[model samples]
Target: MRKLTLLIPILVIALIGVLSSVFVVDEREKALVLQFGQIKAVKEDPGLSFKIPLIQEVVKYDDRILSLDTETIEVTPSDDRRLVVDAFTRYRISDVVQFRQAVGVGGVRVAEDRLGSILNSQIREVLGADQVTSDTILSEDRRELMNRIRNQARDSARSLGIEVVDVRLKQTNLPEQNLNATFARMRAEREREAADEIARGNEAAQRVRALADRTVVETMSEAEREAQVIRGEADAKRNGIFAEAFGADPEFFAFYRSLQAYEKALQGSNSSMVMTPDSEFFDYLKSDRAAK
Candidate 1:
């Protein structure tokens, strides 16, 4: 019974060693087998792998692309315009052995921190170049700038066993201290444009009003001239008729004229005129034939 008990303890120890030597590598992961802190082998495929118990260990890294957002940083463009920028990076571990050598035991966290620094440095260098202005960074040309940053970062990250697949600027904006000032400048510019438009509109309206006034004056002058011509014609025709009547009967024409004159001179009630009794005006009033 004691021998059996000893055999059971041995069996349990063997089982523990087997369990320790056996390890699993997921398909999405790449692993480095380390012996005494040195990379001994790489397991890039899925399924079971073996390692020495109590002496060897496996460090796994993701084989798929990973995303990282860099910290917001302040940068100055060629025009000395200060901007706040943040970016994201897509990367993958290209060499697990180099990764383990570069990062040691610090793992993904340390690598990410270092990678973020590299990205920030490249972003500043590319964006702050003498040929790159704030307008370019804020325009479609920014894509080319991002490509430059990615290329630079990719080269720098090789030492850390990283492959930079893509780099993109997530947000770019003015600093808070400049926001209100920029807004004020924009508002002022818009207001100036509005004033210019209003002035132009007023000028056009004045031109239209002046044209209308000139047209009205011209029309009135033409009508007045036509009316004067018509009056002259009517007056000439009336004088001709009067001459014809006078020629036909001078005595009757004179009597009719004297009656018209008396009616005009004494038209209103209590109307009076100062004149001598022997005046020629009395000639018409004293004529008894005029009453007939």
Candidate 2:
């Protein structure tokens, strides 16, 4: 019974040791087997793997794409406009051995720190180039700038065993201190445009008014000239009729003139006239009396 008990305990310890020596690597993980703090093997493919029982170690890294969001950085374009830029990178470990050697067991965090610096430098270099203006940075062509940054950063990241898939500016904005000033300038520009439009409208209105006034003056002048011509023609026709009446019968014409004068002299109810007894004004009255 004592020997059996000792054998059973030995078998249990051996089983535990075997279990500790074996590890299963997931497909999403990349593993590095290290012996005495030195890399022994790199396992990229997913399967069951073996390591030394107590003296070896395995460090696993994600094989999938990783994201790194950099802190907001300030950059100045060629146009001399300062901007705050937030950027991000998509990357993966292309060489685990080199990555481990460069970062020295600090893991993804350390790699990201180094890569972030590289990306920031590339961003500044590309965005601050002589041909890159603020308008270009803010325009659709910004994609080209980002691609340039990615390519440039990729060259630098290779030393760190990093593959830069993409580099993008997540947000671009003016500094807080410049926001109010920029808005004020924009407001001033809008106001200037509005004033220009109003001035143009007023000029058009004045032109219309002047044209209408000129048209009205011309129309009134034409109407008055026609009225004068008609009045002159009517007066001439009346004068002709009067001359014909006088030529037809002088006595009747004289009587008609005297009758018109009496009508004018006695136009009011309280009318009065002072005249000599033998005045021509009484000729019509005397003729009427004689006829009676």
Q: Model 1: which ten-residue window has the lowest total lDDT?
A: 281-290
Per-prediction TM-score? 0.95, 0.92
Angstrom error of the Cα, residue 190, model 1: value is 1.3
Candidate 1 has an lDDT of 0.95
Off by over 4 Å in 2: 257-265, 273-282, 286-292
lDDT string, candidate 2, 1-292, tens digits: 9999899989999999999999989999999999998999999999999999999999999999999998888899988999899899999999999999999979898999999899989988998999898889899999999999999999999998999999999998989998899999999999999999999999999999999999999999999999999999999999899889999987788888888888878887888889888777777689664485
| Per-residue lDDT of 261 in model 1 | 89
Local distance difference test, each candidate: 0.95, 0.92
User: Against the correct fold, how does model 2 do in TM-score?
Assistant: 0.92
Q: Which candidate is the best by lDDT?
A: 1
Q: Which stretches of candidate 1 lie over 4 Å from their true place?
A: none
